[model samples]
Target: MRPRFVLPAAFSVAAILLLVSCNRGDLPGKKQLESEQVQASPVAPVASSKVVEELPGAAVSPLTVEQRLEDFDYMWKIIEENYPFLEVNKRLNGEDWLANKEEYRNKIAAVKTDDEFFRRMRFVLSRLNNGHTNFLSKEEYPWYLNTYVQAGFGYEPWINVFQQPNVLARYNQKPLAEQQSPNESNNDINSGEAGSQTGKTSGNVKKVIIEPDQIAYLGMRSFEGSLMEMDSSEIRDFLIEVKDYKTLILDIRGNGGGNSSYWRNNMVPLLINKPITYNTYSLYRGGEYAEAFMQARWLTGGLLPIANIKDEQMPNIPPEATTMFKDYNKNVDIVTPYQSVGFKGEIYLLVDSSVYSSAEGFAAFAKGTGFAMVVGGRTGGDGLGTDPLVAALPNSGYVFRFSLQMGLNSDGSCNEEVKTVPDVEVDPDTSKPLLDQPAIKKVLELAASQ
Candidate 1:
């Protein structure tokens, strides 16, 4: 168990010194103020980004099939030796991982062109159960991201975590068996029950015909990225007139991780300005312990104003030490001071096993701040701080993202193994789409009743 620490008493918006050495030519906002007072200091740049360099004695891809196999072997060797987690081997144990690796090799080896080889490589990486593991040549990552964005289920991008649908389809694999029907004529097939099963192959899209009086729902997938960038304004507009609905369902199901600022910038406006201490940080030993900083209680400044952090004067500390203090203070810094807003509406947040990383941080914060009711499944087993550190593999030139700093929730509990358990436990129906699930239906029903 990790020892707990409260955010030091010295931490607050008010405690932050607003040092301004202004000139008439200066502009408004935090950056300008800081620039006038102190020299701009950027964080030490990461030296190792992903690069594509030819390996020694490696065949330049227009090589024979045997050479392609050797290339894959070299990449796997790099992953085995350099992967940060010692237990990564356990996850890849048994014939399954090897079988997939061979399948990828075969596909690549049989490819007639470079495009086909790239496609095979993507298939290989996709099989690696997604812990920031990948097979992209850095140039391909952006395209992959764009491809994923294009494959959307709806206007809002999200994940589908239903297991029953997959299991049942596998159990009733009629399509796989239908190809052996050489004896049957088209008319004969149409007369049989198998024809009816064909229509069922495609999944159903459920529609929730919500009334203006009925409760409206919005599920936050995660809280890490820029809230303004996410279609939050569309959600915000929907929420603005949400008083018509008796209840609001905000599902955080499977949302396990993200930054706290995502909440302060995006969510606070929708609710009553409840002044709550969200979370605190405890630096690891050997880290700098600095003077306290604080900000005063302020009103909703929208996204722009809230993000506008004014500069502070340095306390004449050492150059290196001063820079370290600034970096540490940025994460622990409370840009918007605590204040109150009166929201008369009720809110419910649905949580599930996928809620992890920064999503878990947001959930813990929501619970701590009394912003919403947490309902549904338990979170993905991760509730700690993680500062992403990237490392390049010496042989393959592949980049690996590793967690550096551990995070502590407001209550100082880090559930790396057990995860954040939901307050309301409801099993999701995997056989049905999320819109048709019992939990979402229940939320709507409750809202209607109210």
Candidate 2:
């Protein structure tokens, strides 16, 4: 319930899938599947009861013929019941999701090994074309962690500068005569600052660099650890330090995203001077259990005591719950800016397709409020959905996560269908380091402009 997949750490091949596998609605008793299950409304919950009954954590093992079939059935049923955007996704991608499931289910019996089974499972998930929905075999998880988690450092310009001395020299050795040229603007307040000030805060914010031009750059790799594990005071102090810069560049390229609170509560307030209303409405399947989960999550600040509750104890769902299923018609969240000493200088947000989930949410807020000029490629369009619920397959030990609510922009546009477009779209140059990339240069140019 702690805002599923809120950080870039969750951006692993398996991680994104796992974070989005679970239903955000409720852990209800698995209902019987309808003939046309995909078209059914208020799709049944994945059998929390079955999960509790079958696996018991001791019985789960590698794939057997029967087990593989069961796993396929389990995965398909759960997806059919809880996948939030089958209709929209079908329309957008022109893929027959239900038909794909049936096709994949037939192939399950032919799978000879766990690896093959995993491939088939992945194929089924891939048909959704959703980055958030995914599955990872137990064997694949370790490799995923090693490859993605260890190599999670994305594009950080300041880091590139130190790692490549030539890049530093290019920026630093610009002629002093040129620095004082009549055509140059005096808007760069701390132009005399000598070396770049670079350091990683305990809060996962790496490389806070104040260049000689007084353009402050803060590089954040993932938002997950920084907001939850670190102290808010650290964030406040970091904001206080960078508040004096003439221009601030928040680099979140390749940022997988984390908890929305990290930006909503901590970052947004520091960027905007006034309160702004931003909408991120979501639609969940209507049911008593789902309603209870929604109400509980809202009341507890995104936490739900799912393990403690039984179906009978679920409160009666409100009559309005029926109307809530009208996709994109949900109420708007009028978020008020947090009170703090915020930076009112020119702001730029650096992004890439890897920026997703909570990170994408930050981009949406920044773009929607006009708080910052976005620069870089389109952000990963993964925010327009509810945080997913995770479930473990009883037979295969593979975990699956998926969203249960479709998220919408303030104007009721589907984020899954439309990515967050940057004001200045500059693609990264893989041939050079991040600091030497054209995007960073463009950002610096914008920063230097009067």
Candidate 3:
């Protein structure tokens, strides 16, 4: 379970829109986020002893070449033993990562200093091409994991490193907490004030008029968790009004996911009455974090555990003979229509490369179930699975992280690789507003033709 979409309990995204404002270019590393320091502070619990602390101007012979090689082997071993995307990566990239053992070792052996080693490690992990699996700055891990806890992942933190609510406020970088919001203007629709085809809803929701009563628009910026205290009256009123429209445009671009449940609970039910079903399979290894997350009853039983699988979904299954896959039991979610009249129209989900994690989950559902006609660019995948697990290099105290589960679509394809393809593709015009992008314009034309 990758907690990229999960967070600690105290977080609140109780509005209509998905929230979180990370640009695709801004994420750590795009996964390797560093602040160009010789010695970054590695947190305790994961690494406290023998940690070659990169103190300010302090000379320290961090690790011998042999020790560094051992640490490299440790990193390699854990990923080989537990990480689930090896086969999928091989199938998608046509490059077998596990087979590159000697190649990676040679690269690791050449890096002399701690900084060089860290940079080399980044190059090695980046080969996976996964957003969630990367070497994390220990300074950023707590906030990233806390993001999962608040997003309602419902897991016990095994390492005890994530106790702060800093919300990725480390590295002396601008905090993402302050950056997590979509563009909103006064007279937004959710506010219920008079407006010229535009108004704001709470949280990540925005509404606009594309064709008045015939066409309406809604956008969710992120899927942050637990909107427990938001007043329902405004949202319900908007939903009641939106239900009369002929079509709804559901936008989830730049929605770097927080919690999958936010949409499962808050946005989905109101608009959907009949069941929206899809099959999602995942590969995982039994570890402390994965087991604890499962034991907490977070899975809710749609995923049936299967072992020693010889299937096309994961053709290059992990080298580990005992690796396992959790086959989804065909999840069927039926919700009572909001006010007995869900949106009496079609839904078109707008997407782009920025759509990821739980948002990609939403796009997957739309694509698989035909619940919504997806529009725009392919998504930035990694939508399936649980929150990520963190560990540190014993020698250098360099922390690394990744999801325990590798999610697969209804078909055998890996979610992280295939992503969600658009039904009606259109290049978005960044110069225009979300409501008036080229995709929106194309969708408008499509709706007109209908």
Best by lDDT: 3
Model 2's lDDT to the true fold? 0.52
Q: What ranges in model 1 sit over 4 Å off?
A: 1-211, 220-227, 254-262, 281-342, 381-386, 429-435, 442-450
Give the better candidate number (1 or 3) by TM-score: 3
lDDT of 1 by residue, 140-237 (tens): 32222222222222211111111123211322222323433322422221222332334321111112225555666665654523222333344444
Candidate 3 stretches with Cα past 4 Å from truth are 1-61, 148-154, 157-204, 226-237, 285-341, 433-436
lDDT of 1 at 278: 45
lDDT of 2 by residue, 291-350 (tens): 433442342233323232222132422222233352222334444444556576788898
lDDT for model 1 comes to 0.38
Error of 1 at 403 (Å): 1.4
Give the candidate number with the greatest TM-score.
Answer: 3
CA error at residue 127 for candidate 3, angstroms: 1.2
Question: Mind sharing the TM-score for model 3?
Answer: 0.69
Q: Backbone clashes in each candidate structure, one number apiece? A: 32, 17, 34
